[model samples]
Target: MPTSTRTVAEELLYRIGEGDTERIAELFADDVDWKLDWPEAEHGRPATPWIRHRSTPADAAANFRELAEHHVAEGAATEVERILIDGGDAVVLGEIRRTARPTGRAYRARFALHLTVEDGRVTRFHIYEDSLAVAQAFER
Candidate 1:
């Protein structure tokens, strides 16, 4: 028997949905490479705040802070639609029901994330999501 990568990924996704940033950090390796790609220039102001390129857990904490401060809102919710894991690699498909703060606008989007897990820790993370919709939500 072995530690199922899929199970690990599922727990990770669950923690994310729970808004448990500390638990999320505990799941990452010391030197984790996390990236959220949303070109600010093209996506506009709203998407600008959430985009990040972090190389460590500390960096991820900062990114999460920014997300919580600006992007994550009271009504925001995440649903994991699917998860596929092969060895140390995993892909998660999900949807976000988010409402941008201050403006209180709907910024719903679907997303897919690729994650690499080794020794029960996540080493790499890359996410793809609908940035245009987020930008549009911020439009005033």
Candidate 2:
């Protein structure tokens, strides 16, 4: 894995692929922050969406925890196919397959995530997915 931004991002992907939430939590800092290109509805909801995402390490940890939980029980599993990183940012191309969380409908969607790492943790993220496909799957 990389030691700087790229490495950190790879490690993050590794941990996620391995279903290692504990190690994933350790990568974040106390006052890490983030953003999203999708919307509040994708991750369910985040209370307010107008303000910038100012999250603590606990928040990051919980985010993964929720994802991990959902993946095993409710959501699809992510299958990473390719990844590229520069400085503290990364672009991941992957796909997901399984039942949609909360909707209980089968779906498969291609995804690309732009991520930024800082202090050995993910500080920002923007998610891009086939929303129309996801929505269609959820309806079935």
Cα-based TM-score, every candidate: 0.84, 0.70
Candidate 1 per-residue lDDT over residues 1-140, each given as its tens digit: 12467877888777776666787777778998776667645532544555756787766666666677766466788888889888899999988887766566887799999999888878888989887787677666
After superposing candidate 1 on the true structure, give the runs of residues whose Cα lies further than 4 Å from its correct spot. 1-3, 40-47
Task: List lDDT for all candidates, in order.
Answer: 0.75, 0.65
Query: How well does candidate 2 match the true structure in TM-score terms?
Result: 0.70
The candidate scoring highest on TM-score is: 1
* lDDT of model number 2: 0.65
